[model samples]
Target: MPKDTDFLYVSARIKYLETKLLGKNDIERILDAPGPDEALKLLNDTEYGYDIAEMENIYEFEQVLDKSMLRTIRTLKESFENHELITFFTLKNDFHNLKVIIKSMILGKDNGYLSRLAEISPEEIKKYAEGERAANIPDSLKAAYHKAMGAYELTKDPQRIDFALDQALFDEMGKIASTSRDPFLREYLTALSDLTNIKTMLRLKKIDGDIRTLDNALVNGGSLPKEFFKEMFLESSQSLIEALESTPYHQIIDEGITQWESTGSPSVFEKLIDNFMISLARRGLYKPFGSETVIGYLAARENEIKLLRIIMVGKINGISSDMIRERLRDVYV
Candidate 1:
């Protein structure tokens, strides 16, 4: 493992970049803007101004958001010499493209707008799917491709493909974190895995989904055992919450599940889980030097982009600022 001192130069530079991040106030200003144009003009004063200008209109916010994400990925790739850490951080998009390409092949539709983050072309995945070797794609993705394809063939269910790929994603994340040599990053991934599993369990129960589906949907790498969820699979939400009583997630689960029980929707807990992860990600910010800073900054960038999308969607649709504010997630800055 590299010593903290080894990261001094990169960490210092990241700290300076962190200062330029949009604060809660900046987000609120955009949220409070009278309409879409006003809200966009407010964003124009920030770092996204240049990208927004390139957009034909404010409704193209998703493109601008994607540009922001691309810039962040590019910036981190350029700034950090630790390619493994960067790869681990950005691996989700690669998996996302895998899902798209595989599904598109199944449906005979276009594989649209895959991110260039992985540098592994769509044709590479297609060739590998056809039993030809493609070296550009990661071994993990190649394995996931086979698993998802087989699962889809067996059940003819697109969701089985999602289940297979999602578990592969976390399993691969666990593999990376195990070798990452950063204890907190591993724990961070664990928290995410746990939360995802928890949500899957609660969601399945809410919709009266089969226990076997929950079994297939749950991923490893979380601290809690898979059997831990299976034990309470047939129980009430309260029972599930009680099963989690001694864990750190009890409160969030308590609140999120309670709301979900009443709302007939998963959005509340979904938001809470995101909030929980961002708070967890904040631990990386205080580290003087390490991969932690890189991880923390990347988490901030993701949070910012997510929140911007929420605000923009609400703004363009004529949703009021108060309503939009309610939908906004906590800002990292």
Candidate 2:
């Protein structure tokens, strides 16, 4: 763990970088651009401009975003003394890359979008997925790799790779949060895990999935007990709302249920989840210096990248501005 003084310089740097985040007006400008190329050109005036100005297609644009994300993580890691705090963010990319490798192996294809932001190199993950065992891989990840491979071999289901990796990801996140002894990080992870469980229940309910499947997907360490979700499974939307009423996420869940009832879109719930996360991240702005500040900056940056991706993809596909705006998450600035 890092002391308050450890973050003095880095927090100042983060504050400066926070100003570079895209504002609502900037997002609108990007949305209103005539074409993908023109919209991409708008990035030039922002922090991402220099890195992506020469991007010729969506693939290149995604590559540039990946590079930018990696650059941010590297800069923060070099600036901060607490590598564990930084690893909390980087671990997601590692799990993502692992999932990609597992799926690619199952499909007999070499295609996968590996993010450079991961703490572990993509090459190493690929080596492990290819049956080469190394002493360096984390024990949990190695166990997950083996389990996922075994499941794939038995059932030949690609989705098992996702299920296995996602479970391992949450488990790893829980460990990091506990080891860091940061209240805010623990609360954030708990909320995230609960939200994931709720979303899974709702989606599975639509398909009439059994309790066993739902139980299998639920991650531990969430505030909501597994039994709470298990009982809520296959129940009415109103029951779901009632069950969540005591939770901090009650309002968002209630509103999301109403929106989902009327609009029949899962994006409503997802948008609310993003907003909830952004609100929590925004709270860190009041702190002068701490791990929370760094966490907030990383969350905001990731959300910014997600928003930009949505806008660019919508513009490229000729989606209506109103439609795109409806899908956009809240701006951090």
Candidate 3:
């Protein structure tokens, strides 16, 4: 844990920034906006206004959001003494950019959006992906790139790239969480791994994927044993629900299962889990000072961006308010 004094300045800045986040009412107004232009107008009164005002098209909104995220991360990095804690929040973007670059090369097209949100430059990642090795790139990421490329070469399967990089991402996150020795960070990462494993299992089962594929897809260092999920793979959905009942995610899983049974759609499960994660992230607000506040602020900002994307897309596509609301995740504020 960091000393309270260490977070004094950063926490105050984060708290003030939190006030500018979109509340439920702001979200509703945005949702109820008559058109994409109207919705974009609504943002002018909020922190996103400046970014959205000069946008040429709806698709360009992603750039605005990404810029906001990069700005926030940069601000935190500049303000905070404990840079490692801030790095934890941005590492996923680095891994994501790596995945995009690798996949784009394999596909022979520029399908990737190189995010500035990452700690590492996209050009450096592109160089690494193009068969040039960099001394500055993390060894684990380098290993992941080589392994993923090797897998793709052997199997000629493009999806292997994503699988390899995702595994590496989780492994790196677990290492960072352990090094930090922050219980909240550890638990949060553990839950993420567990939920990821669960989601992967459920998705593979839905597709009748082979046991080998399922086994390879599972990430380690989560709260549950690998064998536990493997054993549950043979069980029915009800049994899966029962098995999860004793875990921290019992309620969310149970509700998701019930919804799945009724609707025969996995989206309910995804939404429930997302809400659960957001709820956990929101708990960081209770602490006046610590890495939790920083982590929570980042998570909240990310979710806020996600919500904006969903709402804007829906408005642009003429989707109904009710449908958009159903897709909206829980607001941090």
Best by TM-score: 3
Worst 10 residues of 1 by lDDT: 111-120
**Per-model TM-score on C-alpha atoms:** 0.94, 0.94, 0.95
N/CA/C clash count, model 1: 0
Instruction: State the displacement of the C-alpha of residue 109, model 1, in Å, after optimal TM-score superposition.
Output: 2.3
Which lDDT values do the candidates have, in the order given? 0.82, 0.83, 0.84
Candidate 1 residue-wise lDDT at 104: 84
lDDT of 1 by residue, 1-333 (tens): 666676677788889878878889999888888888888888877778899898886677888888877877777667656666767767877788888888888889875667665546767887787677845677878889989999999999998988999999888888878876778778888899999999888778877898789999999899899888888887787888888899989888899988887977778788888888888888767887787888888888889988888888887888988987866778787
Question: Model 2: which residue pairs collide?
Answer: none
Sort every candidate by TM-score, greatest first.
3, 2, 1
CA displacement after TM-score superposition, residue 50 of candidate 3 (Å)? 1.5
- Candidate 3 Cα lDDT to native: 0.84
Q: Which 10 consecutive positions of candidate 3 have the poorest summed lDDT?
A: 129-138
User: Can you rank all candidates by lDDT, best first?
Assistant: 3, 2, 1
- Residue 63: error of model 3 in Å? 1.5
Off by over 4 Å in 2: 153-156
Reference-based lDDT, residue 105, model 2: 71
For each of the candidates, the C-alpha root-mean-square deviation to the true structure, in angstroms, is 1.9, 1.7, 1.5
